[model samples]
Target: MNNFTTFFVSGWHHIVDINAYDHLLFVMTLCAAFKLKEWKQILVIITAFTVGHSITLVISSLGYIPDNPKIIDLLIPFTIMITAISNIRNYGKEGVFSNKNVKYVIALIFGLIHGLAFASNFKVMMFNDNIIKPLFAFNLGIEVGQLFIVAIFTLMLFAYSKILKGEHLKWNIFVSGAGFGIAATIFIGALS
Candidate 1:
């Protein structure tokens, strides 16, 4: 019985697993949304996403609404494509908060949708013991996973910035387009 419980508990770890498609898409979208520089901007965007996801995740998990995992699964990819589009449009812009707040706002909104996707899994986990603690822990794990991926991406971009010097924008477009394409594929696949 104890082993079974431990196995079940371990499964919650996947909720935040960065390698997971949903979580990866969310992080990619957020990272691609804003031009990278300075930890403050990253913090603002990440915080907004976290707050948004946490709100909906907690609400849906608490039975505020019966969340449909399939719907959210599809929407998650759409959110990624939207964010990638936004990023592609805003490439090479300056000022993190000057009018870019709209993008972050969208991030927050999409974050909520992404949270709904998570709520499905969390709701199942709720059947176990100490629901609140596990839920909070899982959310924290997600944040950790997001931050880790963002940091790696940032570092990679910084390195490329130093290398290419000026061609980064072109690369950004290519990468963002790739992300959008991948997202679109996922969304379509989910729908079909």
Candidate 2:
């Protein structure tokens, strides 16, 4: 592979890595409350997160933010837990597009935390003299990975919606519960 492709592919794999799935879990939880019809809102939410992580990724890559992997490791799952719980609490009351500002803010904040985690690895791996190209490629790769996850999630939710025949709340609960359980496990593992 070419140099650019190498960096981009590395970033994609890093985010979507099955063994290290905190990022995927976060994306899943963030997108869980929406239906396939709410694609616009989902795009906005995903953009918020991308912007958030990009800000911190750039800052951290420039050495402005310290790489605190342990703290970030814990905070990552905490963000997931918070998002999952929010879905569980607001499942029925809030429409898919309601309170979007709130979701955007959460996604941004959590994305910043997740960016720090990304930076811990990025700083070590990035070797180019001009950081802009590789950094942009890496961020692009992350967005692609995130969008892939969102697409799969949207499809799964759509299938479940059809299967349940309007009992989508149960699907939401199941996704949230699973997110919560996984986040809790990661949070505990980070502590140990």
Candidate 3:
């Protein structure tokens, strides 16, 4: 395969891979606060994350930032936990997040940190002189991967709410709590 194709696949595989649960958890937590009817907001939040991470990836490509893996690792889970806690805190509050502007900015900031967490690996993946094409392709691939995840979560959540008449507050708490628990575990593990 060509360079773009190789990096694209790598990006998709990296996000969807089960071992990369931190990224997946972060994405899921972002979506947990919204209902099925709020898909547009979800997409915007994910896009914000993509944009933020893309910025970091580009800057990292230019060798501008320090690659502190330990701190990045801790920050990744911390962001996830914070997002989860936020969702849980606002559970059942309809208009609490009605204005999604804050969420977009938060996602963007979190995305920047998440991108830093993977900067070393992403940098190593670049082998060609032409970085723009591969970088664009990789970010596109990651976006697609994140969308796939959002789609699956939306469907499952939708089914629960529709078929079982699931309580929105209950689900928000459950999903967000799960995110918090897992991220806390990761954060603690990284502390060791």
Candidate 4:
């Protein structure tokens, strides 16, 4: 494969990998609160996350951010736990997160944490001579992977909405609860 394709595929698979699914779980929880109709808001939230991680990825790649695998591993699952709990708390009370600003801020902050997680591996793969192309391509691949995940999640929500009829909140709560459990497990593992 070509260089661009190699980098893109590597980045894409990095996020979507089934064995290492912290990223997937985080994205699922992040987008779980919104319905298909709220695509614009979802896009913004996802973009904010992308921007957060992209900034850190660049900084970390340049060696500006210190490596702390233990802290980052803990934070990765911690962020997921936070997002999942937030969704659970806001289950029926959609008004709580009516302010998009709060969501954006959360996404950005959590995205930074996630970026640090990404940076550990990213630093290993980066080339010193040509950082820009690979970095941009990698980030782009991540965005595309995120969009793909959102699309699948949106379809599942749509199906649930259609079949269950007004049970979207329950579905969100259930999924978020599961995510929280998974994240908690990972967090405990990290502590050990």
Q: Quick one: best TM-score, which candidate?
A: 3
Residue pairs with backbone overlap in model 3 = none
Clashing pairs in 1: none
Better of 3 and 4 by lDDT: 3
Q: Write the per-residue lDDT of candidate 4 for residues 78-155, one digit (tens) a residue.
A: 999989988878655656464678899889988888999878788888766678888888888888998998889888
lDDT of each: 0.68, 0.83, 0.89, 0.86
For every candidate in turn, the CA RMSD to the true structure comes to: 3.8, 2.1, 1.5, 1.7
Question: Given candidate 1, what's the lDDT at residue 38?
Answer: 51
Residues 1-192 of candidate 3 have per-residue lDDT tens digits of 998898889789768999999999999988998999899999999999999999999999889989888998799999999999889776665564545897899999999999997788888988866779988889889999999999999999989999999988888889999999999999999999
Alpha-carbon shift of residue 30 in model 4 (angstroms): 0.5
lDDT of 1 at 98: 34
Query: Which lDDT tens digits does candidate 1 get at residues 9-56?
Result: 443344345456666756765675445555677777876887787788
For model 2, the superposed segments whose C-alpha errors exceed 4 Å read: 94-98
Q: How big is the positional error of residue 168 in model 2, measured in Å on the Cα after superposition? A: 1.9
Candidates 3 and 4, the one with greater TM-score: 3
Superior candidate under TM-score, 1 versus 2: 2
Question: Candidate 1: where are CA atoms >4 Å away?
Answer: 1-19, 92-98, 127-132
What local lDDT does model 2 show for residue 130?
73
Candidate 2 local lDDT, 1-192, one digit each (tens): 776787789778867899768888888888888777789989889889988988887888788997677898899899999899898888757665248888898788888888888786777777865778877788788888888888888888877778657566777788888999999999999999
